[model samples]
Target: MAGDKELAGFILFLSQFPFLQAAKILTISFIGGSHYLLMDEISRILHDNGHQVRMFRQFGDGMLPGRQAQQSPYPVSTYSLGEKYLAEYKALFTEAQKDNLMGRDSLQNFLIFLNELSHQCNVTLHQSDILNFLKEEKYDLAVIDGFNPCCFLAAEKLGVPYIAMFPGTFMNAAKVGVTGPLSYVPIFQSLLTDRMDFLGRLKNTFMYLGSHIVDKKMDALFQKVIDEHFPLGSRPSIADLHLRAELWIYNIDFSIEFPRPLLPNIQCIGALLAKPAKPVTQELEDFIAESGDSGFIVVTLGSMISSLPLVEFLKEMIDGFAKIPQKVIWRYKRSEWPQGVNVAHNVRLMDWVPQNDLLGHPKARLLVTHGGLNSLMEAVYHGVPVVGIPLFGDQYENMVRVKAKNMGTFIPPDEMKAEKFASTIREVVENGCYKTSAMKQSVILRSRPFPPDQQLLGWVEHIIQSGGGGHLRPYSYQQPWYQQFLLDVILFLSACVAAIIYLILRVIRALIYFISNRKQKQN
Candidate 1:
């Protein structure tokens, strides 16, 4: 039979790596384009190594076509969240684009939005045939996007050991417990550098507490949904699932992100999604060739920012692009292009752009980005300087690092103006320091012990062969937070010291009283 031949071929191929065994790997991702890219790479790596890989991704429009899995080597299944949920997501994004001061209220709204998403995911998964698929597939490992709880729930129902993939900078501060005193490491959504002054450190501590609070509240909300869906008996809490993950693969590097104390189970496989840059189309090549010495700037605000609500913001970008002599390629996703605007001959607007290829082009001078991790990593891989216009979420933190590393300057979205934007663009394009710094970072990023894909493949196989690598988990994950941080020890020692001081004071008082009584009797 054809199935028998396929099985035999896989067995023979896997024989080349005697110590390694092929695994049935399942990657679960939803909603985000960048997440799909990461998961697709994971699936590709596993499949290329003679493993059976299956992917379950959410189906929807508005995702960039380029990020989609075109000709995947393994089987992929899709789930639908429907237009109602899609509209809700759009509303959330529109609300975020308003650029209100990120305070407690904003964080609360964000958490509530995430809960709504979790409910939608729960409903979709329940409606889909995912459980039956899992039963038939008999998967050996489940790779899940850690940000969402739905996949975690699926993996649990299937009763499979899994690892979590965090596609961006550290999201769970409490889980990872990164370097420095709590005051030093900035919290999620913190637009701060690692080197904090007194006030900054104070703010950082509050942000840490605030994040923990928000996570606890969010966990409870998600847990209620999990209970409803899995109402058989007690299920593991979401935090428990995170702690039990055999390994965590982060998409950031220490060269860009601040150094943190990572656990043995954690690893950074940055920029693994990018392949060797392919040549652009002849038309694009001609456009770049005609630009001559003045190279073009590639501008994109990432896939999530589909439309600009403010007409002035779009006009400002247009005005800035028209003034620049170098050719411009702006990748904007909007159903209707704004009217009453004069687009310059040097500027080109399209729904999507070949971002990685263009960044690698010889005639590419600079990149203007919204500081998404995927965009930043690609820009760094190609040794291109960036002009970061941070909008929200980790974008602000990502740009802060860009500026800290001297690779670029950050222009806050609220403070953007045509003249200032153009001036800053000119400054980065004209300055050699930015380019030198970016190239230096590029060298550091590429100087890993091994290629990122191979490294990831090795770790993933190790997890599979070693029975989820249970030995790699830190002892601290099992310990209470107070004990892990030695807070309990500190408290016990302080209590003993206070008791000894009290006893010493009582003995001294007794001695003084005896001396006074004897003196009085003699007199």
Candidate 2:
């Protein structure tokens, strides 16, 4: 009787807290750089939450700098193609860079990159061993890299419901039934903000339509892989498969992104990597401390491109840094520095810097970046102003947000001069309004009802416990294109109006004829 009472007391104590059930989750990633980091962070979050998590990473070339030697805490299954594919992958970036330098259209190179991804997908699917292993695991859920369509195909093959974690803005939000009114909501890559002039809206309209065309071309590339791998009758269109995802988690925050409508199944968990700053190394701390009231600046062009391609551009940047009073810590390869160029007295170049740590430091004043989303979010997280030097891709678009928010400004690469670059940097740093805006954004982000981690964890668990996100999904995805956009209804209304107008005209004509005939007969 005493033992039973003790057990009942213990159970009662446990009932005070919410109970959580552990889940088995598999994270699929085939690309590297920021994409890898995002997926890796997701897996870590799940694992830390007492879930059974495993990572399946397929090796691609161009791993993020400083992450090459880092190891994961959870179990990881890694696969790699031969050196030939690696060499080819590296060469593609070089060719694309050259195209950009020569002012040639680089869209062709981007398409080639998509084709390469498709090829990699095709090769990976044929690996019987990997397939068997994944099947044997029998994961309860899959978290996929949304940027890579191959990850979606892999999840489909495994017959598991998956969540897509997109590392960029939801440019394809329409695919999942989110409304993006072109009149206000700027199309991705268009670089326009929520507020636009007439001309801006007109340009946005064209880009909005062009986006769909580009998506179709991209889908066609991936469709080839599906055709060869899946049975003919069972093949699903890439768009359909995307629509079927349990949820779409975008790496964006309203603090940095323009205000836009979102559906229940889509969530924004931007800056997943942002956290409390850890203390920097003793050597770095000493350097930052020496900056005194001026405060040090963090400079990095993201992980992909460490060095400028043109010597003149490099010299301009160096000369610009020379003019600044505040010390600069730039992430540039020492070997890539021109032999004759003099190093700035206030600048320090290192192969890598603990970016988040430096940004979070009390003495940190500014960030000089390439306008990558990850870097932008980190800057927002730490309340640091920016001077963006956009290289390519969505970098330009990302900078637009920076300028719109009044947190910083950007310099076009082609138009960059030492005086212009230095003046822009100084203006942002010396101006109190820029820093105030950045800090305000940081406060808004941090003061949200649910922090990013909690949001991710709670929603993921909700989906798992609820079996799927079908309850949250809207029926819009199932509607035909015309019906979804109300085009059919619009056409029907137009036809009805036309019929009514025609009938009114005919009645008027008859009335006039009858009056004229009556008058003639009376005469």
Candidate 3:
């Protein structure tokens, strides 16, 4: 009798708080590095909020062993790509780094990377065992990594509603019926800001048109995967799958990104990783205490590039650090250090540093980074100025925003002389305005109505409680391309005006002829 009463009470309590109902969530993480980190963080948030979350990780050949081996609180299942494919994926990054080091264009590398992703997608779908396991789980929702189209395919196969977590700004917003004006809004990699001159707008327009060509190419690459796995007649295009996402959680904020139109289902939670600083270790604290009035600078070139043996670049950077009075804490692998280069007296090189903690410290004067969005957002959160050395991909574009915001400036590899690099660092550190601007951005980011984690949790629960994002989805997604752009309406209006002008001309000609005939008859 007591047990029956307890059960009845539990049921009554659940009825009062619908959100307390736990959801079974499946997250797909195909990429490693910071991409994997973001997915892991999301999983942690959901798991802590009474949701049963599972991570399905896909490992490639060159992924760090540490990353693959790291344990998660929730259940995790992993799939490894074929040795040959992963090897190629790893080699591509190395080659791209070489090109960037030499100041050459690495556009070809991106194309190759996309091709590898398609092949990996093919390999993943062939795993019937994995697919069956996922299907058996019967998850209520899927959180997919937007970078990989294959994740979307997995979700579609399971027939579960999904949300895409884009790790950067939504460059492919148009794929989901959200459009940005080419005039003011810069395209993904154009490296142009929101404010542009006439020439800049012209360049942005061309890039905007060119992006479609790239999108079509990407679609074609993945179409083969879709055709083989999905039924021939019912196979949905990649764009169609993207449009079906219930929500898009972009790792971007207007505090860093320029103001642009957003859909109701799209949310920005860029500072997901930002939080209060924890105390540093005894050794690190001792180093900071030694610096005294001259605070230290935190330097990291991201995970991938930090392992490369760029002797020339490292030499220049070492010399630059020697010139600055501030102590330097750089994230570089000691094993990969060039043999002849002498280490700077005040510089400390470690395989890894507590980047966020260091940046949040009171003595942190500046951040020297590769301009990754993760690092930039951390810098913004901590109100630390930056001196960026953009290596590849979106790093260049990210740095453009940093400079535009007046938080800091960047030095290209071609211009990376030791003197120039040192001067750039000093400029940012000495200029109070840069620090002021960074603090202002930090305030703006922190002053949002809801913290990033809260926003993420609340919105995710809302979608689950409401049974998908149908109510939030806009009608523009279902419209034809011409209709979405109003080109058909414009064509119709143009035809009507043309017909009216033609009819008026005919009437005028008739009147002229009648008047001429009357005058002739009178004569």
Clashes of each: 0, 0, 0
Instruction: Give the candidates in order of TM-score, highest first.
Output: 3, 2, 1
Residues 1-523 of candidate 1: C-alpha lDDT, one tens digit per residue: 9999999999999887657667888888775667776788888888888988898877777455333435777887877777987788777766666543222235656676677767776765585476687768898898888777777777877788888888888867576544356556777776778888898888888887777777778778777677777755667787787787888888888768887677788888888755558999898888888788989999888775655666777778778877777898878653556777667788877677888899988888899998888899888888899998776567778898899999998787767778888898999999999999998988888787888889888888889887786898878777888997799999999999999999999999999999999999999
Summarize candidate 3's per-residue lDDT along 272-311 as a digit string, tens digits: 8888999999999999888999999999887555565567
Models sorted by lDDT, best on top: 3, 2, 1
Q: What TM-score quantifies how close candidate 2 is to the native fold?
A: 0.93
Candidate with top TM-score is 3
Lowest lDDT 10-residue stretch of candidate 1: 97-106
| Model 2 clashing residue pairs (backbone) | none
Provide the clash count, candidate 1: 0
Q: Deviation in angstroms for 497 in model 3? A: 0.8
User: lDDT tens digits, residues 1-523, model 2?
Assistant: 9999999999999998566688889999888877887888889999998999998887644667433467788998878877888887777766665555343435566688889989989888887788888889889899999888899999999888999998887667766678578889998778899999999999999987788888889889987789888998999888998899999999999999998888988999999888889999998888887888999999988786666666777788889989988999999877777889889998888877788999999999999998888889999999999999876767788899999999999987777789999999899999999999999889978888988988999888988988899998888888888997799999999999999999999999999999999999999
Query: Whole-model lDDT for model 1 versus the true structure?
Result: 0.79
Which candidate, 1 or 2, would have the higher lDDT against the true structure? Answer: 2
Show where candidate 3 strays beyond 4 Å.
1-17, 60-69, 82-85
Cα distance off (Å), candidate 1, residue 414: 1.2
